[model samples]
Target: MPKQDNLSGYNNTGSDTSVFFLSGIPGLEAMHLWISIPFSSVFTVALLGNCTLLYVIKTEPALHKPMYYFLTMLAVINLVLSATTVPKSLSIFWFNFREISFTACLVQMFFLHTFSSMESCVLVAMAFDRYVAICNPLRYVTILTNSVIAKIGLAALARAVLLTAPVLFLLRRLPFCQSHVIAHCYCEHMAVVKLACASTSLNNIYGIFITLFIGGLDLTLISLSYVRILRTVFSLASKEEQLKAFSTCFSHFCAILMTYTPMVLTTIIHRFGHQVAPHVHILMANFYFLLPPMMNPIVYGVKTKEIRDRVLLLSHGKNF
Candidate 1:
């Protein structure tokens, strides 16, 4: 297996394996150690904060509503998202070993995008939960019962798995006889697809399909939910009451902002910002991956009164 077809400079890696080398942040290898500072810090915070959020939501009966249940789904997604990429990235950053088996790379890409889609789905669910809570407060419980929440979760899992399955299948059929050096920290879908020697028109089409499925479909639905929510909030007679109603949605709005802003911005830059530095694009793309998981718990912990109080009690070593 002459795996060094396109990677001439990396002759030290030899030329007889089915592995890919993860190039940690193009044009920023020297700064990997310094870069690890923020990555390590954010990854650590993502783990602790999401774990705490899960613990608080599970143990505190008051925090078990539809909003919090949707939040629990988000927390679990964050844990998986960060766990999938961060440790592998840290290995590249700290140990400088990037030999991921071909199968492992595909698995990494699978989990990364699958959970990313689920994150988007969970966000849409949260937005709908808020819409019902504000728009139909009288029937909120009746509408989003425990069984409905479980069904929503199952639907999210099904959608994610089904939508992402084709991308992996498409990639497996391509011949990766080109350079196996995957630029960027993770084996992102398009990044791996680009390594194929064969024409990737099908893989490209699948990439666009999943991107539209996630970025297009999810955003439209979330937007629709929030628009309805805003209409409901503004219909209130008192300004104070309107503000109070909207406040309940503040944390979810923050989650949406963190989750989508960087991704949308980076996608734009990638499509149009040809003059921009490569590292800048990679940093922006990676930002969307880590920021949401790390900030979700913090935003919810501060904005939601119930989660905040419980988190505080736990911080102080007091009984919940």
Candidate 2:
């Protein structure tokens, strides 16, 4: 149960708490239609691209390897992340429906953060898969078997839930005496926490701690895995073999860069960029959530010959 704060002056009690107003973009009310155009287009492409990636992986037997399996998991996480935030964002833009119920807001916050964290974990797992394939080819299959892949996916989800569940509890305890208008598009953790009249030091501390430890630790492991992979690739006698092995990791590396760069910049902006305009923060937050999902499929489809050929085959009315 949440520890309710004193509400003597505020008109609303616990039962009377109402919806929160999600401001889509702080100062661009008139240009919402224009904004919706690009946002809707990106959402559509992300949906189609990720869904197609999943379908190709499912029907193509050649893509049943561990790397593709991790790719499938990545696609699913991207879908969830985009689905949870984009529709509501579009609704806010198109229909001016910006009111999110308090409970629903919390649910959205939970799922968005959960899947984002899961995506990070999946990327780390994919890095490990690449490392094994390049540096220890003899044991790749034995190491990342079907059962082990399942366990990795499960662990990713479990880690996300464990880290995000406390945020909902913490939000519930805070007394929202200030205006309920959120300055961003969605229910971001810090955005919502900032609205609370009560002390938010614990929430801020925990959020930063989880972000640094989970995200930082995952990134460190991925970097180390790639370092080993590159070292092994360089040791190969033939230049062709080195290029072939490194090519396999290029798409995943791009995906990581897309994911973490925006995330790191947005975190820095939020914590330190006090003089920055409100709309800038909102736009950066949107990029942090939107860009990776919109680009991941395109990256893999263009970079991976197997997926590209399968997609081309499907497009030409041939068997995948």
Candidate 3:
């Protein structure tokens, strides 16, 4: 059995605390089981879908290109993000096991934020791949070689680690002299920080800066890359060629919208939706984290002919 933390000792001071209580969904105690049904379904789909994506990409030699390599990284990050949050959420919803130790919460916060940041970086890398393919087809192979792709993956990992380290350090220094009941499904940065007794202005400022710097910058670059890609696509002479180029980007565009739109919405609600119902906040947070993982594989499976063909072949019991 997994080790469980005891929360009986925690009080208003939180000085000698060992555990934090995760309130699954505030004021929805009677319907916790009902809520678990949908959450469980989504988590199951996310796990199977992302695992299938990774397996197909690994087995198919045709997927060894730079675009699919970046996709593999995206799948890994999605798996990590879902795995980090969903199991604990289900435990809370179904079994009423919500006492998470302080150390465990910090660890969860680190991986959750790190994987989220890495996903953003992976999307930017995908955008760059598409930009090169559309704008400079001749140099696509030369520019995004295996070496370059590996470097981009490493850089994404490094960025996540370096940027999130300070947040963890600051959290460690704070004296959490308050109720340790986290009123959400998972351990989020702001949610956890808000439980601290001391002023969190610096933490808030740094958090905002990182959000804008990493996520904002990545989104801006992706937009700019697509702008350039659009310019290049429009310059093509044949209508069929233009459609072909744009079709290749349709899946990625859908993915970007799904991943970022909910994120932006959730951030806005977290910062400004003080009057919003607790369940509304929790639902949006769940959507922001869960929807992308569950949807990305379906998007790619439908949009990409190669992956679609492979999936069909595997389902029919032929060699993939």
Candidate 4:
């Protein structure tokens, strides 16, 4: 019943019985390399994609609109998120489940959550930007000016910092047992907290609160913005204008689905289907954290004409 073998296929009784955690799964070293390959690959793509986005926004005067400003914020958040996890995850893969100190794990969890929450907030801002452009076209510039966009940026960063900073303090109060290994590829809050031997009611409660505030709040705002936008679009006198308005929001809508769907799926699986295969958790975790950023540039470029032209022009080294 050694602690290292906790949660493996061992005795499931007695105080000394190991819990056989997911870290004890055999051949994870090999699996780690497989996992790391995709992680590194996507990280590279995200870096290039988001950097291109930032560059296009910075250089192009025409791209200096509210929509592109919010897109820039999303790109920045994506860069941070990919940088936060992918390098550490790659290192862990090469090292074969290396032990992370409790403090470091907590720090990773905090960064991951903070960047994710910030991305969600930025997406909500993007939705609002689109709403203004489509529904309030005449005043879109006045309403979503540089000053207002700056304020929105500050608000998103503030929400993420305020929400995630407290998590570090909360984690500092929790004591880890001998079984300190985490289950997933990264130091996720819930997965790491599962290793705590101390009373975790407070941590769980606070985690739920943060999740709701970040995830639920952002999703609800985006939904409400779209509802108003749809109403206005339908009220347009010209069918062409209605189609154009809806088409303009398509990229943002795709981004929302890519970001939120995996999260909602993970929440449901972790709550109601914990008994599912470990591989399921691993797959969902990767998708939840990785896919959105990886697909963002494609979503925006393919669905939005301006982005597509910029990307094509950049590819050709043209001044566009």
RMSD of 1: 2.8
Q: Clash pairs of candidate 4?
A: 6-19, 6-20, 6-21, 7-19, 7-20, 7-21, 8-20
**Most accurate candidate by TM-score:** 3
Name the candidate, 3 or 4, with the larger lDDT value.
3
Write down the TM-score of every candidate: 0.94, 0.94, 0.95, 0.88
Stretches of model 3 off by over 4 angstroms after superposition: 1-15
TM-score of candidate 1 against the unseen true structure: 0.94
Off by over 4 Å in 4: 1-29
Report lDDT per candidate. Answer: 0.85, 0.87, 0.87, 0.75
Relative to the true structure, candidate 3 has a C-alpha RMSD (angstroms) of: 2.7
lDDT of 3 by residue, 63-167 (tens): 889999988998889889888998999998788888788899989999988988999999999999999999998999999999999999999999999999999
How should the candidates be ordered by TM-score, best one leading? 3, 1, 2, 4
> Which pairs of residues collide in candidate 1?
none
TM-score for predicted model 2 compared with the true structure? 0.94
TM-score-wise, the better of 2 and 4 is: 2
Q: lDDT tens string, model 1, 1-320? A: 33222335543443634677888788888888999999999999999999999999889999878888899999999899899998998987888777788889889888988888899999999989888999998999999999999999999999989988888888888877657788778887777777777899988777767777789988999999989988888889999999999899999899999988987888778767989887898888888768998999999888988888998898899984
TM-score of model 4 vs. true structure: 0.88
